[model samples]
Target: MANIDPIDARILARLQRRCDEPLEELGQHVGLSRNAVWRRVKALEERGVLVGRVAVVDPDAVGLGLMVFIQVRAGHHSADWLEKFRRAVRAMPEILGVYRMTGDLDYLLRARVADMADYDRLYQRLIARVDMGDVSASFVMEELKEGSALPL
Candidate 1:
C-alpha cells in the first residue's frame, strides 16, 4: 500500500462511507477540484488502495437469512490439498468469505443460507470435495456491525 496523506485519507474515508457519491460532492467535501479528486481516486486505484465499488445488498430480503461460520481443520497441509480446498471454495456461491488463520483452526469460512438444511447441503458438498479433518459450524443470531471500510 502507498503512504496515504491527509488528503488521500479524507478521500478514502468519504469513499468508504459511500462509494457512489458524485465526484463533485466528494470534491466539495474534501476541498479539492473535481478533476483533482478524480486524479486522486484514479491514483488510489492504481496503487491498489481503492479496490472496487460494490453495491451493498440486504441478505435477509434475498432469502439468505441464515449466517453460519465454519471452522475447518485440514486433514493434510500440502499444496495439492490447498489447491483443492481453494477450488471448492471458489465454486460455492454460498461461501462468502474464507480466511486461512493462525492458531488451532486451519481455515474459517463465513457462509449464508436460507436455513439449516441449505447449510447442511453446502457442508456435504464442501466435505465431499475437500479432505477436512473436522468441520464445526456456528450459526449467527445477530450481526452488530459489517462493512468493507478500513480504519484509514
Candidate 2:
C-alpha cells in the first residue's frame, strides 16, 4: 500500500469528490501550496494510487436507463472456456463490469441498457457467444446510492 499521510488523505478525499478542482483550491483545503499539491499528485500517479481520471456520465441522460445484474453459471470450467468467456464479455460494450465470483455463482455481470427489449438483446448476444449452464438477471428498481469513490 502507498504511504498516505493525513494531508495526502485529505487531498485524495477532495479529489474523489471532484478531481477537476483547481490545484490552488485543492492546496488550500489540504494546507499546502499549489506546487506541493502538484508534486504529491504526481507522486500518487507514479505509485499507482491514482490510476485514472475520467468524466462520470449519467446513464439516464445517454438513454441507457436500465441497470441489470446478471448471474451466470458456466457449463464448463476449462481454461479455454474461461478465455472464450473473457473475450466475449470484453467485446461487448454494454457489459460495464464482469466479475468471477465464488460460491454457487460462477460469474456476475453488470450492464446498462435502454429497456427490457434492449436487455433481452444483450442477453441473447451473450448466450449465443458463450455456453452457460444457467443465466439469471435482476433489474435495479431504484438506486439509493451509486458511486465509484473509494473510502479512504
lDDT of 2 by residue, 1-152 (tens): 26898888888889999999999999999999999999999999998888888889999999999999999999798999999999999999999999999999999999999999999999999999999999999999999999988888
Taking all chains together, each candidate's TM-score versus the true structure is 0.96, 0.96
Per-candidate Cα lDDT values, in order, are: 0.95, 0.94
Give the Cα RMSD of candidate 1: 1.1
lDDT of 1 by residue, 1-152 (tens): 25999999999999999999999999999999999999999999999988898888899999999999999999899999999999999999999999999999999999999999999999999999998999999999999998888888
Please estimate how well model 1 matches the true structure, expressed as its whole-model Cα lDDT. Answer: 0.95
Q: Tell me the TM-score of model 1.
A: 0.96
In model 1, state the lDDT of residue 7. 92
Q: How far is candidate 2 from the true structure (C-alpha RMSD, Å)?
A: 1.1
Collision pairs in model 2: none
Backbone clash pairs in model 2 (N, Cα, C under 3 Å; residues 3+ apart or in different chains), count: 0
